[model samples]
Target: MKKRFRSTNPVVVGLATGLYPFLYNYYSNFTLVDSLGQLCFFVAFFLLVPVAINICIKIASKKIPFVAKNYILLLTLSNLVGFASLLTFSILGPKKKIILLVIVLVFLLALLLKKQLKKIIFLQYLLALIVAFQLGFYIINNLNFSTQWKQLPDTILEAKFKKKPNVYIIQPDGYANANMLKKPPYAIDNSAFENFLSENNFKIYPNFRSNYSNTVTSNSSMFAMKHHYYKNPKPSSKEAFGLRKSIAGNNATLSIFNENGYKTSLLIESPYLIVNRPKLGYDYSSIAYNNLSFLSRGFDMNVNVVAEMEKAIVANKDQTNFYFVEKILPGHIPVSKSGSEGKEIERENYIDNLEKANVWLRQMITLITENDPSALVVIVADHGGYVGFNYTGELKRKVKNATLVNSIFAATLAIRWPNNEVPEFDTDLKTNVNLFRILFSYLAQEPTYRNQLEDDGSFLIVSQDVPFGVYEVIDGNGTFVFNKVSF
Candidate 1:
């Protein structure tokens, strides 16, 4: 008889090795591959693990005959634990159910081929070792390395002032200024809005750009008063940990604000508000739908957020507050499905929603003014919208060719300072990175910081796919003092 060769199973070995990393990626939204990669890896590993076990049994029958009898049971138990862990930690949805099914099927198949199960266990152990080593290296490297400050500044100080002013920074997510909204149906003359502010003695910095394109970086930078440098395209396990640190570490903006004697309160709608990272040190923070159990219910998060803020203000009218209001406009998806449909229906709905939010804001402003007319109101946007090319354009095409998902419209900045000789700055001032610097100057009332602000030379840097072109606003006298991107 010819000698037979025993071989390890490729399917089970390859899959178990790949499942851990891909599952991690899916949870983090790290890449496009995550959606399908995890399933494929798990199935393959499950099927092949048995084959590897059989090969091992044949090879070691004489030395360890007992291994052949018990290997299948051990393999089955290990796979059960792995799958159960994945299910427990999953975000809970149809995706989770489908993944659980695959895990079950693979485990069953491995058990049916009990003779080959021993070989699979050996292979799985080896793969597990590799994964453990990779994780170890990542943790060590990320924690040991010193943080790099590539674009941020050091030592941001408020200008010296006579007395503390109640600060209100309102960020309207995806709100663009009027001139930039000139793309047909979405375009508004904005002159009316500008005139309203002008009459109210509000200084409008017509050309203010966001520090970054996304909320996480943009908001972090706004509070920290520093440039963000953590941009990893293919972020590894180590890189993800580093990003977590950057967002919630000791040097975060909230910590700085607390240190400066500001009683900080954040009213936000994003899920990030409840993320159990290290506390950045907020006096109080509330998100939309605080008690809602279902994810779909959280869709209308903005509505709940506005309500909470209104209640908070009404309940605490006596105290001077530093409020950071992150207003969630009807900008993101499910816009039409959020009980608002049809073309005209959506537009009308959007306008109505904005008006409602504006009404709440106006009420808060009135209350603050009544309490102290000298209160500082800094209104801006977290980012801009990526609606249609024009208001009436086909929504499908616009969605297909959406801007780099990074390009946001220029944020609107309308500041109202009380009791000061506010200059009639007719010419548009290009202000972006200097937002913190400007706020500090006004709060501290140090004219020297104003001099520093005037000397600061900075340009707005927007990513690709956005309509990238510089604009200059001329006053009645036709002087161009500021130049910035229109959208």
Candidate 2:
């Protein structure tokens, strides 16, 4: 019996190796369609390499006949080049010397395998199959993460506001609650910031905590006005599919604002919020530019979102506007930390960013008050800094305590009402999940909507612990519980 022949195509292996880093880093943010589209674009990009190789082989055939005889070797060498170049720049992002070292190493390996191309074709196919399987697994797991709620409940929508003050939600990412900032682990003097808010007639919620720990999940619940209980069936700790859509798409809260004849504007410093290009419901969205590079870390490239804010405020002065201005200030703790010294360094870095955020806050408040004095501005954070522990491995730590857990879930929530017209429900505004509900109740002058607000329970996932690791970290009274619940 004749043995089945194996194709000597190394392009499949090259494409898979080159694409792995992008897909792995962003698969959580991407829907199945997004993943498929990216896959096709990359495939088309990688196909160019083989086409060029074949052209070179044909052109150089007469002069160097060995080129045509060793076509497989040329293809293999090109594949190796593609893999090394992409993996180094796209994922590793090492220094110049490190990149040179990687190129040199890949060149040496290719030379070593120059004569054995046919023998290792099976191995190449194996690697490609593995990547394909993993992609399929991610898509299958995240299929259930669809848009659960597209519009707000009827009670929230029917609520009517006698006053139509412009609203602004300013988010300083990862800024902790005032109480957490004043306590042990964080022990920083935030009185100046608090005093500034107070002078501006802003009421700070002392015991505010987010319903979830991460930005996407926390904001997902905030916009939906519901407790997720980590219900998306996380494909991995890193992947929370459909949460971005929950926040950036036509979310319930944004839809209601649109229905109420308010112009929704999104001012983002970085492209992080719209990285996957979710259909943002905001009538006017501003960003300097969308950097679509592979494996982008989502940092601002000198993009002045404050300028955009001022522009939006001035442009929409005549219209009732709801602005969601997000700035990644006082960002999360560095992933790389060593001993006590590393911890201290990271803490100082966080404080430095926090100071910058305070300055930005002052600028925003001054801009709004001077231009539109009757606007209602809210200063809310997505989640805490995860200061002491590695954010990714937070749930796996055995030494977890109530204070550490509380600090992780803590967030800043302060509201500046127009003419200090704070409503009675403002006192009950304890968590981000119920923040909009209380605001809607106040706006509609409907006290009954407050009764329907979800209980302010903070749920977090013990990512490393697996299948049944979802836990209630904070209860309705804003106290830490640390009790594990079924996932």
Candidate 3:
């Protein structure tokens, strides 16, 4: 019973495994407690599995008695694989369950054959290398986050409109325009949706695109009305915390609304991102940013957000003017459908989701018009699809082989005003950067002056391979010019 059984220290192993993800989330300013809770679970899962495996091994390997140190090594090795895979479950997509099952079965078999496993060496140093790699990954990502653009200050730009209307801006995530949606593969029939909108006096911009192909970039640009110009290497490292916060915290959009005496409301699917949400002046409702990791933001929660909108904005009898900005992600991957088998509907989940959102939109509009009689509704999409089909074809290509998430620059834009007088915008081939400019011009009754804020058909759209991945300037073109820059 000589004891030199050098078992892996669970504390070191846990921290080494969980540190990067923790830092990755922390850099984004997600709440520490939620992330810590998940990290603790991750550590516990890794540690408990080995203990369970070790107990089973002692039972199965009494006849095949082996060195205790070898068992420790196998457990540690199993832990490394398990915890790493678990932490990255979202990115692992469908294979995570399979991987977990495989790890469990392999470890159980290895423990049963502990006599042969005793011969396994060299893993001691290999485990050290893995820990070092994890530490390095955390350090690098931390540094990447640290060096992003400085925080944007809370701005209070003043603008006064003669008549204030309750504004509801629903930014549907990944909703592509009719051109991209009606393409051959997807062929999502948007005409019914458009006609419904048209009948209600919502004009769908047929040729509109987002200023950038990325969500944060496009939305931030749209709200700020200034495209964050991409440098040679994209200076912000794709996290673009400043850009994210400018919208989430201290952007000119919310400021203008606040200064104009509107009770602002900010709501999104998830509130944890690269910003201090409290700094964003909002009188009503919005989820605060934190470090909590969310898997799919459940269907019930999203449905409840609309219900909340109805309660807070649509059905509320308050006399104060309200400006509510919410992100309604209908076109999220695999697309969420209520009361279904979680399968794609009508061979086009995005379309189905959009239509459902349309139904909700109609309800909101009818309610608001009934309550206030004067309200503006702006329905826009952040970017296009990442699914196989999008706006990329030889006919539409100025630059060949420009498939950043299937040319996700093509975006959806539509606007609804009280009376059915079509306000003259700069152009139908407008990018999302000019969204507010159009509204300002129309609302101010001075298109000739307010049109100056528009992009002038020249703005940059950024492309990133992953979430906050290496940002590159994608190739695109405007209405007047043909260029390699993708929008």
Best by lDDT: 2
lDDT of 3 at 288: 38
Q: What is the C-alpha lDDT profile of model 2 across 108-165, one tens digit per residue?
A: 7887786665554555456556656776786676555545543445567655676788
Which residue segments of model 2 deviate by more than 4 Å? Answer: 1-39, 46-73, 88-101, 149-154, 232-237, 288-297, 300-302, 336-341, 390-392, 463-467
In order, the Cα lDDT scores of the candidates are 0.47, 0.71, 0.52
Q: What are the per-residue Cα lDDT tens digits for candidate 1 across 1-487?
A: 1211212233353345345533443333322122233346434443345445444544564467585556445445445445343434333332556666766776777567546544554655664566556655554553333345323443444234454666777777666545444443345445655676676667877655554444555555555555433232222421222333343334434454555666667666664433333334557666422342222212333434556556766765666567777766634223233343554444455555555555655655565566557777777775544333233222212222213222233566787776755533323234334565566655555444444332222222322333332222222122322344332
TM-score for all models, in order of appearance: 0.58, 0.87, 0.65
lDDT of 3 by residue, 221-319 (tens): 777766564322232233343555556656667767777667777655455332233355565554533332343222213324555665675444565
- lDDT order of candidates, best first? 2, 3, 1
Relative to the unseen true structure, what is the C-alpha lDDT of residue 101 in candidate 1, on a scale of 0 to 100? 73
Arrange candidates by TM-score, descending.
2, 3, 1
TM-score of model 1 (CA atoms): 0.58
Q: How far does residue 48 in candidate 2 sit from its true spot (Å)?
A: 5.1
